[model samples]
Target: MKDAIFEVNNVSFSYEEANEKAMDQVSLSVPEGAFYAVLGQNGSGKSTLAKLLNGLYLPTSGQVLVCGMDTADEKNTWDIRQNAGMVFQNPDNQIVATIVEDDVAFGLENIGVAPTQMPGRIEQALLDVGMLEFRERAPHTLSGGQKQRIAIAGILAMEPRAIIFDEATAMLDPQGRKEVFAAVQKLNREKGITVLWITHFMEEAAQCQHVYIMEDGRIVMEGAPEEVFSLPEKMQALRLDAPAAARLAHRLREAGMPLKAGLLHMEETAKEVARACKLNSKA
Candidate 1:
């Protein structure tokens, strides 16, 4: 029922040099403040879609609209980029300043924010990402996750309504991934920022409100996380895996256990298994 923050209407895009389209007839709408996950194998157009949403790549055909502004229109390009900021895989690529606070100020500086107002925005953005304590530290001295958070802070300072995370956790270690994921999740939950999370990690996608699976530059499946992930065959066909908890739960169901659907988390799945055991013992 919420207003759409992003709308893709029957869009198709081909690369200048490639024989095949990078995106093909894709249509999707992301409501304001929604968390949407996009899953895909390599070269599946997920990244291309991110670029399109942020105005880095205009759709070759059809349309991509961010905050109701068409991306193909050159006039809307600047506002669209600010309206839908992007966080990419590499933190170092986005970190332009020496100190943590300074990096957070980079975007604000580009937009010509008043000198006096910069401090408050920088402080708030760092605080949102839980990196305020490290404000004075050198960016290169920080851990990967911390650097990624700083990268996020840079975007957050600009106060964009939406953010496109294009495999933002791909280069991180498990803990680093968790750190970055938690930060983004907090922003989505507390601040109501719309999120477009592009990832190959099934567990990460399992936690989102909506899921879309891409294969060969097209959306092959989309629904609530439970609905899309419940079909393991389609995931397997695309060379993707369901979350570990979901996979194990599916096996238990096949073995005649009356476990419920949408068991995406390990703790929840374990609890359900224990309850099922209790019922069996009673029987």
Candidate 2:
């Protein structure tokens, strides 16, 4: 029961009154307390899948289960929402209140957290995200990273079982992006929160426990990061980028060097290069 938090079984989706299905027979499962990254180009159904997990959109066919709660059933909708919360791409769009504390308190207020409990909940939420000092500050005054953290704090106040980041770093500068990603990773490591992160960034995708690649509204590949991203040519065919290490190794192999597949980081590639150089010297 604790191993799998989300189960999407052959799910398909079409926008309201639309002709084409946005998601076509897509399915995947996210394990509890795992960091999973979804990668694809624009309109690849990654965003649509994230929404289904959080109950923003119901599946047109098949099922999306969140901790045994079916999202398609209206009775389980509220409970499903409380269990899985979404943090979107734009920080500005997620800001509902002018002040940081109000933003964090918004979700709790909606669930009608008792008056006596609101203060403790809000404070703990901020503290968890390391934003307690900024609780009184205005939302607009914070950095992009800080704003996103507050948005997440709002959801954390609800004590969700998982968090979905839908291209949450797409709109920020490099520093801001790093801040947001770091904060999210910290929470997952310390709090054991399952994270379903959707992004096109290859570097970010490489950090996850597993990677799922979508194409034309379907999952084309799913595997551990090294296994999935190591194939540079295939990733390019899917209109996706490969991690730098994998790409570099691919090029080296193309130039007639003997190299293994799926070297994802610089350190790993460096070791390979040194090993090859020593072998050449011995030969």
Candidate 3:
């Protein structure tokens, strides 16, 4: 567990005046430099878990830690937030500056980054996300994908070791979604940043190193994409959809095509189907 950057222990949470627990005794560990995709239906504790990571919400009973900094501790709160930055659902809500570079540098400025060093950090952040071309452009003129990438640039400028994306692409179109996902993957691969992508998109989740399926505030299942999604019936029971390829494989199996499950990509599924047909013809 040396690589574990965040640890949650018997965490439970509920609104001060709410009737039911939003998150029940949920626990997990996130490793540094790993891309973890958290999926679930509504009220399944996905967002709540994201909040707990950065000390946005203290556990009602148990403990949550960011790089060993406890979320419930008042003094360590700043450390926790600094270690794990969060990107919320709405990109506009996270944007502050009219210009792209300024917005990206906003976090560094707030943390008292020396004015002399701001330029290099800002430039690097934008360039990393492929937004340097529009550094001087007004954010309002940019597309959703552009805006979201800019928002992420702001966080990256802070140089956090990890990030939690809570449905960050929920508001974007297909192209925008790809842009966001690509940026995230780039960060994980190029910069070695730990990424916790909380989303419902099976395709997006398929890109992760690991996937956790949650339901009714519990982690019903967790594993690699092929291990978890191979059981279509289990994923269906959790109210989670499989990736396009996995779904096609499921349909083919149902149709008596005799293809194997656990197909996370179209190429793999197609190859399996082709093999089945080839063998059938020989028989």
Clashes of each: 0, 0, 0
Measured by TM-score, the strongest candidate is: 1
Over 138-205, each residue of candidate 1 has an lDDT whose tens digit, in order, gives 99999999999999999999999999999999999999999999999999999999999999899899
Q: Candidate 2: misplaced stretches above 4 Å? A: 256-260, 278-283
Q: How do the residues 1-283 of candidate 3 rate in per-residue lDDT, one tens digit apiece?
A: 4568888898889989987888888888889888998988777889988987888888888899889888888999877778899998899999999989889888997888999999999999998899999999999999999999999999998899999999999999999999988998999999999999999888888878898878877788999998988888887887777887998888888888888757899888888989999999998
Ranking by TM-score: 1, 3, 2
* Ten-residue region with minimum lDDT total, candidate 3: 1-10
What residue pairs clash in candidate 2, if any at all?
none
Candidate 2 Cα lDDT to native:
0.89
Candidate RMSDs in Å, in order, are 0.8, 1.8, 1.5
Per residue, candidate 2 scores C-alpha lDDT tens digits across 1-283 of 4568899999999999878888999989999999999999888888888888878898889899999888888999889989999999898988899889998888898998887898998998898888999999999999888898899899999999899899999998899889889988998999999999899998999989999889878999999999998888888888777888888888888887788777898899989978877887898
Clashing residue pairs found in predicted model 3? none
lDDT of each: 0.92, 0.89, 0.88
Q: What's the TM-score of every candidate structure? A: 0.98, 0.94, 0.95
lDDT of model number 3: 0.88
Error of 1 at 149 (Å): 0.3
- Residue 184 in candidate 3, Cα distance off native in Å: 0.6
User: Can you tell me which runs of candidate 3 are displaced by over 4 Å?
Assistant: 254-258
